[model samples]
Target: MSSAAAAVSAKPANSRSRVLLASLVGTTIEFYDFYVYATAAVLVFPHLFFPTGNETTALLSSFAVFGAAMVARPLGAVFFGHLGDRMGRKTTLVAALLTMGIATFLIGLLPTYAVAGWLAPALLVILRLAQGFALGGEWSGAALVATENAPQGKRALFGTFPQLGAPIGFIIANGLFLIIAALLPSDDPSRPSLAFLDWGWRIPFLFSAVMVIIGLWVRLNLVESNAFEKTVKTGQVRKVPLVTAFQNNFRELVLGTFYMLATYVLFYLMTTFSLSYGRAAIDAAVPGLGYDYTTFVLMMIIGVVFFGIFTLVSGPWADRFGRRKTLIWVTLAIALFGLCWVPMLAEGLVGVMAWLIIGFTLMGLTFGPMGALLPELFPANVRYTGSGISYNVSSILGAALAPFVAVALWSAGDGSPFWVGVYLTAMAVITLIALLLGRETRDIDIEE
Candidate 1:
């Protein structure tokens, strides 16, 4: 090959690595903020933001606030997806990181219900919406950045890099909270009160400032995505990417959204519901060894490490087996695992460990393929809008209602957690069917 041709090819490969790195770091921080709020919703928000109710009611209210973020996600997706397609990917990603960072940092400063009454929960909901909107833009932009810049024949593998950010972010968020909880003095008769509510809970939210600065610096250095650049050169950028996406890619959007159901439902079941179940079981004198709240946090961190490893593994497997095939098998596995929830949870600490390890492994496999699968289903022109809308909409349907539904089911069942397992299993079955019906896009030429 001529030197000019060789140099041209080399440039994009080098740029792709940088793009992947930038997207990975920024996405990790964004999700760190997002998951930090989720963890707080379970452990702290019920006490701090909605302190007026009984335990169950306060927990339900906390999850309701959590759902508010999911509700705003689709709106954020539509707004940012338009800008990303028309203006550029780099610009949208940078803006998303800043929006999430500022909102999360400010959450640390908000007054409790004791000080602000109804206004405290009201303000929390508004900030939660801002966080949701920022995250709505985050995934699609990061996925496009990785996929667009990837080397030929390796898009699936490269695409998983950004997906890796989710578990890493989860670990960082949960790990920080666990550390803080550990440092506080126990409230048992033998120990002094550590005053967790007075100060400890705020530390994790406050630390978001450090991550935000680092994420912004990395994102600012990234160049616009090559797919978007090609759109500009060809004068094919959509004036209303969301409209165009709906007009041309509605079928794929529906399928992608449903295909994500199992993952989202399983996500909340494993993370949020497990925390509540573990704590309640411990307090109720269940037969098996019980875990304190902090123990559950530590278990989740362990699950995240496995989550990252499986995500890495799934990318190469998807490239070899095709996205649809890989996803179908993973979805089926999740459905089957959901059935084991009650039995496992009943077994105490050992059962919980087994449950998390198995559940998170499946989560990794399915999540890895999704980064490539959803975007590849659409043509490059509307990829940002199509993938962004489908993803965030799925978050609303699957994740937003998960905690609320699980709690209601548990209550109606007279403290039986088996009903929660059935709910998650149903979502997995839907995802399995959706994956079976979807096309395999692993070999589709990206520029098409």
Candidate 2:
């Protein structure tokens, strides 16, 4: 075939629906696997894997392991980002999905500390690392898949398809756990049932296999996006995307990593830390709101509904107002929101629910544009590596430490969440500074 004919032939036959579905499903599965582990880190791991005798110590240990995964994420970014930038997004995305699925499924089968001793937590840490690694690559690829195939002026809007996965995944993962706990009711409503602690928690991890299969089916049907195809045809594919990313786009790398800082911290705080805080008995050494496990998860699910809504809503706003400008306003709101945590959570159920709703709403707004903005920061030659590294490294700085730090701050405040709110505001301020230093990415020609 002639060069022109080959170019025409290489145009993806994938419909818009297929592109959106493939991107959305892959991330849904990825985040579902992640949120399952996050929920388990709060609900089960402290009891099963880390028996430190003290409640606070055990929970801290579980969170430490959870945070360890964040350390592996940047490494995953380098490895899989290389594959994606050089090999193509389709195969790399499939590999990432498979990796995360296998790790999550294996987590369900692992023996608890009571059965296997120290080796149990050791193995859990390894598998958690694998999950983090896989996810490091997953988001960038999904974001690329969505934005690259978007029609003119719609990249930001299309990008939200993948961003939507966070709330969707959170709902499914937490909702399933709530259902399982409800079915296996213990005499006390506040704590997890014995059955749930023993086996029900594993169900969510094992269920990942089913979702992975569906994600694989959708992603396997995808063709490379035209933006990436153009790079391939032009012979612009980098031999070492990671190195090239740093060499050519060092500023974007720094900016992108910090840009996501507030989102990471707020999300973990809302889901993991809040679950631990909301459910602890009011008279405990570290007092909490004293809600039951099921009730708190339900509240989080309700809050996540706003997360999903605002995620989609932010997309159109980003497309219309410019990604940077919209995100600047959202980040500022997140900063202000952080200051209100004390008053909000102190008000009882009405106050706590309002706090959750508002926090997650801001999470959606801040997180939505990143699907396009990060990828748009770099040209196609190293976009996968650049964005993946930035996103995951921020996971280490922001998410990996958020819960652990919040727990410490909560203890320091003598059960008050004031210090935790301060920590969040500090992170938000960092994100805001980064945003100010960065350029608007809404109009960037990603194909270049």
Candidate 3:
């Protein structure tokens, strides 16, 4: 090997710290920017953006706008994935973070339905699409950078650094909301009272700037991935990794997308749908726990803490058991766990806590190995393009419509959670089948 090539091959002492810190911090900001919207969609958007005064239509419309981001995610994946593969993962990662940060901050500045009429929602959709697109390439790139930098035989455990972002982001986002909600309490159920919709909620959205700055500082100091570095030195980088992924890696894309559906389904249902249902008016046509808003959020805080912890724990589990094997049992556990939705929800707050604990635990397990499993499925040349696109594309199948569909099912069953549980079960079953079909690549060499 040439001196430059040898330098690229020889891992630096600081590379692991740079990789893990960048992955964890960058993705935490990314998902933090993403999830604050999910929380708003359930708590504030219907009144602020839609303002129809009719419950179901307004809620559905809010979630539809929420789903709009997911629709744009695949396109973002294609664009950013191409950039990451061709140019470099660091460039794409930086760009994606900037796009997300700027867009989220702007959401704090948006005019409400009362102020701008139809233009309000139009602008919201546009900004949300921007967030989804930037996020498309962000996650897979973070995963690739971390796993690629890992020592042999520990990729899954190392990859958890990026995966840790999801729960960390979840906790931070909800925790921020709780803090804001404490400072500005709103008691109206039909509406959030102007105080919250007006300025309180924007605190979290505008706070994206600080998070972005911290993430950027960490990422900018980072070393680039060894895989991409090696690919560059070897002159193997695809001219357009997006096109190359389509031509050769389509199967991995499809299976990987399906394999992650259960994770998405469980997440949205537990977090977003639960928030909406738990605080919904008990007498309404849709089923709900009707817990006080503050109380339900407290339950969520507890759930999210467990979510964050298990995410870290699942990493070593994946490392020891093999990614595929761990995922298979975990996915199956998720499928069976879905059956508990009825009794669990029926048990009220305790049941809700139990339900959330189980779902988030399974979520951490199923998702922890994904950062390793996804990029490992692709060749180094197109790994970023293939893995990023597949991962984001799955959002449409899994998260995009999950809350909307869950509410629709609840309405269908006259406030029953029966059909919603069925939906969760089915998504989990699909993920299990995909796991069974996918090749075990835990021992596969990522460099090739």
Scored by lDDT, the top model is 2
Model 1: number of clashes? 0
Choose the strongest candidate by TM-score.
2
Error of 1 at 360 (Å): 0.8
Worst 10 residues of 3 by lDDT: 1-10
**Please, what are the lDDT tens digits per residue for candidate 1 over residues 226-303?**
566567666687788888888888999999899888988888877777777666643442211345677667887898
lDDT (Cα atoms) of all candidates against the true structure: 0.82, 0.92, 0.86
Q: After superposing candidate 2 on the true structure, give the runs of residues whose Cα lies further than 4 Å from its correct spot.
A: 1-11
- Which is the better candidate, 1 or 2, if ranked by TM-score? 2
lDDT of 2 by residue, 57-167 (tens): 999999999999999999999999999988889899999999999999999999999999999999999999999999999999999999989999999989999999999
The deviation in Å at residue 323 for candidate 1 is 0.5
Per residue, candidate 3 scores C-alpha lDDT tens digits across 1-448 of: 2554565556454377788899999999999998899999988898889878788899999999999999989888888888887777777899999999999999999999889999999999999999999999899889988888899889998898899998889889988988888787776654465688788999999999999999888877766676777787888877878778779988998998987899999988988888888887788777478777777878887887788788888888888888889999888898888887898878866777898888888888888889899999899889988888778878998899899899899888888888899999999999888989888878998888
- Candidate 3's C-alpha runs over 4 A off are 1-14, 189-191
Report the Cα lDDT for residue 353, model 1. 88
Candidate 3 clashes between residue pairs 3 or more apart in a chain or in different chains: none
Q: How accurate is candidate 2 locally (lDDT)?
A: 0.92
